[model samples]
Target chain A: MDRINVCIIGSGNWATTIARNVGRNVANSQHMEPIVYMYVYEEIVDGRKLTEIINTTHINVKYMPDFVLPTNIVAVDDVVKTARDADILIFAIPPTFVNSCCKTLLGKVKPTAHAVSLIKGFERGDDGQIVLISQIIMRQLKIPCSVLVGCNLAHEIANDNFVEGTIGCRDQKYFRLLQDIFKSATFRVVVTDDADCVEICSTLRNVIAFGAGCADGMELNENTKAGIIRRGFLETLQFVDVFYPGCRMATFFEACGISDLVTSCYANRNRKLAEAFVKTGQPLSELEHILIPGHEPLGPVTAELVHIMLEKKGLADKFPLFTVIYKICVGDQPLTRLVETLRFAREDM
Target chain B: MDRINVCIIGSGNWATTIARNVGRNVANSQHMEPIVYMYVYEEIVDGRKLTEIINTTHINVKYMPDFVLPTNIVAVDDVVKTARDADILIFAIPPTFVNSCCKTLLGKVKPTAHAVSLIKGFERGDDGQIVLISQIIMRQLKIPCSVLVGCNLAHEIANDNFVEGTIGCRDQKYFRLLQDIFKSATFRVVVTDDADCVEICSTLRNVIAFGAGCADGMELNENTKAGIIRRGFLETLQFVDVFYPGCRMATFFEACGISDLVTSCYANRNRKLAEAFVKTGQPLSELEHILIPGHEPLGPVTAELVHIMLEKKGLADKFPLFTVIYKICVGDQPLTRLVETLRFAREDM
Candidate 1:
């Protein structure tokens, strides 16, 4: 096999963290090149091009300010140029930008290149079906796409704190290669063959985190928070089974499943925003704007998508936790109904 | 078909909470008698018999102060008299006392009686086999046994905070009856048939909680703490499959499994002591003596039993988390090795 070239297709906090991991590994790895190209969507940072600042200072000052990127990681403003001749493509951009970014990479990347999506959340198709971010990348770029998901907080990963991530890939060879690129002493990786299950779990956990935040905002006890999370987990499994059957039950036990959900519920932007939504009686949009400026909070939006999908299948009633979160977000129901809805739903189950 | 007479075989905090639940429910339930008998090991409280004080004041002032027992619950000093003629028995005392309590009820209890164990630890047999507390009760009293386990912190349940518990019973008929006794609006119960799995999970969780506390005391980040918990859960499942095959995977999804484990790791006496052990370098015995006097911290002791059981089978290496916890508690290993042991163990897996 020829030496592999690696490219990260986003310049966000998570993307920067991935760059650090890959950049460090690729330096000594015989299978890949030392240089890692990160696609930077050219913005002005401190009176300089963001890409230039990243290249010169070896830092993603805008998104991940404190962490220093490895010197081997190069920044490219053009998506096509960044992805050109790359053997490994890592997609860590927001789901909203995946389509546009994939369009730029269309027919530019090598045919043999394999991709791993660090992107979470889903996109709505023309027929109103949920499309995973990885699916979009694979469809547009005509390449095999795997996914990585877990309880990883990007800052913690950047700081070299111990964490575990799950890689969901069908191809065992690619899975091993991806594991080599990402896994470190502190950043451990586990692989599974159920990509769809892992991706779906990653998307749905934001909604669960929203519910956990509501519990926190309402001053509900830890037991109630845990109950909501546990129920949310069961519902996530059920949703995957109903929509994407044949996924293994053990997949939900992986880092992509219960571990990620637990971390998001206890600590995350979604949980924080939802807690503020209940405590301040403010809209989620306003809180998102204040808490995480210029970023779309995925939980409420994903809840809306899930609500629509469940309704389309005439199974809205079966997913009360997701439905209640969607309703509360859209002002169709009061926030106070969150815990009661979950409790009653469990009884019905 | 007959009215069930209820008896509680302990007067500790948990037993008091169960008594309150049954006492309240039985009063309005046609299937059970309103009068509930509680076996109280005789003690002097404020110059009066503990049983007399409980009967007169409707409060277990010594064990569960600030919570009132239902007036219909009558306390008895004699264990045999408490067990006599009772159609339903609940064993909520510590495992150390289970043998003596069951010995007293050996032939005195009616054969028609059914029992559920709210006990949370294990006993070792002569040949070093691990024994479920329910097994002891069943062998001694000749009755069907079911188990209840979950994140029901007694104080939380007593305060009417919402929580869920799982009942594992193979007998569907007895399952429904036990649910009726335990379930309330705030304290919801879910039933499964994997009684042994549930019992094993309940017993092993204390050891996991100790590991979690060691992580906290070592000042590991939340992600690492969550990592330890997730690993502990996987080990729990593996332990059950190795020791008790034919247990359904879905059983771990129930409240008795994941929910209980999460609760114990986050907030419990064992976790607290283990945290202190790491922080102060004190033996578990001294810490338990100071922190929770008269109670053997079940996690360390359970770890010892699990270690013995696993060592007996020559499979001790398979469960590093359990082994390391037991070693730390027994002064065989240093406290600092806990996280590294868990991390390396995952790699080996």
Candidate 2:
């Protein structure tokens, strides 16, 4: 069999972590390329190009500075040059960068390449439908794109901590191949055929994590917090049922679903920002500026998009928690009223 | 409609919390008895019978001292007299005492009564089958039995913090009645028609909590802890599939299953003691003596019984987590090998 050439299309902390895994795995295997090309977007960092610094120091100084990357991961600045002739393309860029990056590699990627998206947010199409990053990548590149999602905190994975991720792919051959590339002693991967479910779950869990944060900021007891998380989970299930009709309910039990939601609710920036929103009585935009400067809190944005989608589909009434979250984030409702909102929301259930 | 007389057949912390909900709900409604009789095994506290003290002070000072019981919840001593004409029996006693309590009230409980078991542990039959507490109640009293289980921490519930519990009942009438009695502004109930699944999840979750504790004791990373929990959950699903064939897969998503497991793994005494076991290298019995005084850590006992049952059916190999947890608790295996054991366990998956 011909060796599979792997390329990573991002240079963030998560992207570097993926490159570390792929670079190490490929170096140890005879059936894959020993070198991994990482698209770096050509940034200057402290008198040198970021890609040059990464290739020289084997560290991502901006995002993930503590861990050392595998030596074989060569960083490239040009997207088309980086992705050209690759058999596997791993997308780990921010959601905002995906479209422009894909435009640069529209027809440059190998026709037989299999893509796996690690992007965590969704986009709204012109028709007002929520578009998965995988769908966007597939639409742009004319290749089958799957999703890799779970409670994978990059720092944890970098520390060689035990973690599990779900790969949502339709092709069994790609599933096994991706699993082989990603699965290590510490990082385990499970595959399912519901790519849309995986992507949707990864995108929507931030909203639920925000709800958990709101509960925590209110100083609610553990039971109440657990109740909010559970309610958020059920609402997500209901939303997926109504919006993504063919997604199996059991997919919600997988790593990309409940596990990711649990982790995000307990430990994530979204939860922290929402908690700050409740504690300080400030809007999410201000909270994001203070807590996570220059980065958008995806929860509120996703909640707004979800609100629009639900309104178009006449599902606003069906998802009261999501609606209330959007209202709270947008300053239409006070955070103090969250408990009562959840109470009223549960009554509908 | 005839008024339903509710009798709570235990006077522990959880029982007091249940009586608090029932007492308040019944007092506010005309369809049920305003007075709730809670059977307390006669014990002397400060030279007075425990039941007498509860009736006078409205507190289970021994078990739960922080919260006051409702005024209308009268305490009784005689098992038969307590449940004599009751239309709803809430069993909150430990499994060890259930048979003797059932024996004393075998012929006295009202034949038309419906029962809900709040018992957390399971019983092993003479033939080595896992006996659900509800099954035992149904056999002893010839009444339809259901279960109330969830992430309900007793003190939190008593403090009037918001919480949710699942009622697993095959009878719709009993489900509605139980929901009415238990539901409040702070305490909510969702009903499912899978009583066995509910009971088994509540019982088996202690084992999973022990696994969580073991992970905590070993100082595994959060990702590892989450993986153990997810794997434990899947194993429980597999166990339910084999032992209780008709249980719905969706039942595992309910409050009784994932919610309860999450809470127990996070905060319960079983998880704490198991963590101590790994930290101090002491057996659970010794740790229980120091940590919980006289109470048995039900996780290990349930694990033992589950182990024997699985061995009898030659299915022990199917549940490696449970087997390894049992072995770890019994000193047959070291706690540090937990990650490796879990790794081997997932290979079979």
Cα lDDT tens digits, model 1, B1-349, are 7788999989998999988889989998998888999999899988999999999999999999899999999999998898897988888888888898888788898998888899877787887678888889899889988888885488888988888888888798786778888887788888888899988988888999999999889888777777778888888988898889999877787777777887888888899999999999977778899987867788887888889888988878888889988999988988767767655775334
- TM-score of candidate 2 against the unseen true structure: 0.95
Residue-level lDDT tens digits of model 2 in A80-126: 88889799999989888889888888888899998989887877788
Docking class of 2: medium
Stretches of candidate 1 off by over 4 Å are: A346-349, B346-349
Worst 10 residues of 2 chain A by lDDT: A340-349
Count of clashes in candidate 2: 0
Model 2 spans with C-alpha error above 4 angstroms: A341-349, B341-349
Clashing pairs in 2: none
State the lDDT of candidate 1 residue by residue for A119-194, as single tens digits: 8777888767788888888889999999999945887788777888899998988867888999887888889989
Candidate 1, residue B2: lDDT: 74
Share of native interface contacts present in candidate 1: 0.47
